[model samples]
Target: MITIKDLNKNFGKKEVLKNINLKIEKQDHIALIGYNGSGKTTLIKLILDLLTTKKGKIEINNLNIKDNKFNLKNICYISNENDLPENMRVVTYVDYILKLTLGRENKLTELSELFNFDIYSSTLIRDLSTGMRQKLKICTSLCFEQDLYIFDEITSGLDPVSKTKLINYINTELITKTVIYCSHILEEIVEVCSKAIILNQKQISDVITINDKDKFINQYNQSFDIGDLNHE
Candidate 1:
């Protein structure tokens, strides 16, 4: 569980997060959505301790982000800006990540097969296509079985088949985990997330649960006027 209270951040004269308060329980799959520069990423960074908070209290399962950096091994963050070493093979990179987190080499073959990723075990990451590389990154993150999974626009470059496969995998395999994903893709969020948060005006504008998702989506679309809602 994660509890944030009065969370605030500032960059020189501009404020990013403003007195944000949220409570995320275990097994909550939440999708954070907002327009670019609306502070969605900043809030995630604050929770991950990638950015320092000017004023707030962030607690992860009774452990503070500041004091429990090492204990956060239970959390996995797959961000767009973070990249694997170009020279590392896909398999080797996954293996290294597993070894570093779990202190053992395990499940490499199973996960690769599950994702239908068949790149040579020795192929360098730099040579893989963008979709393939994203698949590898997602595979590596899921291999460790972390309690908290944070994916920031993780499905950006994925094809339709890959996207469906990944979403199904998350629903089936990660039933008990807390997954917080930030994406501008509404359809994906509606399909996978049980709850949604809309960030606007430097604060959480709305938080809605999708009990009757179609109706929820209709209302959600009507609430914001940002051009036609692209439905697929």
Candidate 2:
């Protein structure tokens, strides 16, 4: 489980996150959404220790994230683009990541087959197309088994088909794993995440569960002055 309380962040004059509180139990899939610069990514970075926390308490499975006792063995972060190594060959990079995380090759092979992705094993990352890179990124990230998976704008530049493939994997393969999905596009995550967290005014404005998709989307659209999701 993850617990956060009284979280706040400021950049000189403007506050980013204010009095933020959230609890994520085991296997909870949450969608973190907000308008641009609403601190959604900051919150994820704080939880992942990519950014320092000055006035908040974050505990992952009751282990303080700010303390030395925190172990990231079960936590995995798949960022939009920063997580990938640009200079390495696709196969080499995957092997290196698997070696570091103690993951298996068979898993990557399976994901490759599932996505019909053939460039990872032979092409250098620089040579692959943008869509292929995103596909490779997902294949590499998801191949490693982790209790907590953090996806930060991971599908921003993918084609519709690739986006659906990633969404499908999150829904099917990660049935019981804790997932924190951060994306500006709500529809892509609504299918897999059980809960939706709306960030606004430098705090968590609303936290909703996905009991009814239509009702939830209507409410979500209203929050952002978005008339309808389908019209986007």
Best by lDDT: 2
Clashing pairs in 2: none
Worst 10 residues of 1 by lDDT: 223-232
lDDT (0 to 1) per candidate: 0.80, 0.81
Task: List model 2 lDDT by residue over 116-217, tens digit each.
Answer: 787346677887777778788787778878899999888866888877878888888898899999876667667878898989889888888777778778
| CA error at residue 21 for candidate 1, angstroms | 0.7
Candidate 1 TM-score, C-alpha based: 0.90
TM-score of each candidate structure, all chains considered together: 0.90, 0.91
lDDT of 1 by residue, 1-232 (tens): 9999998889988988787999999999998887788898899988888789659999998888888354767888886664779888876776677667664344545666777886347889988888778878877777786899998988867888888988888788887899998887788887778898878788888888876667767767755543443334
RMSD of each: 2.2, 2.2
Residue 228 of model 2, lDDT score: 25
Question: Deviation in angstroms for 203 in model 1?
Answer: 0.3
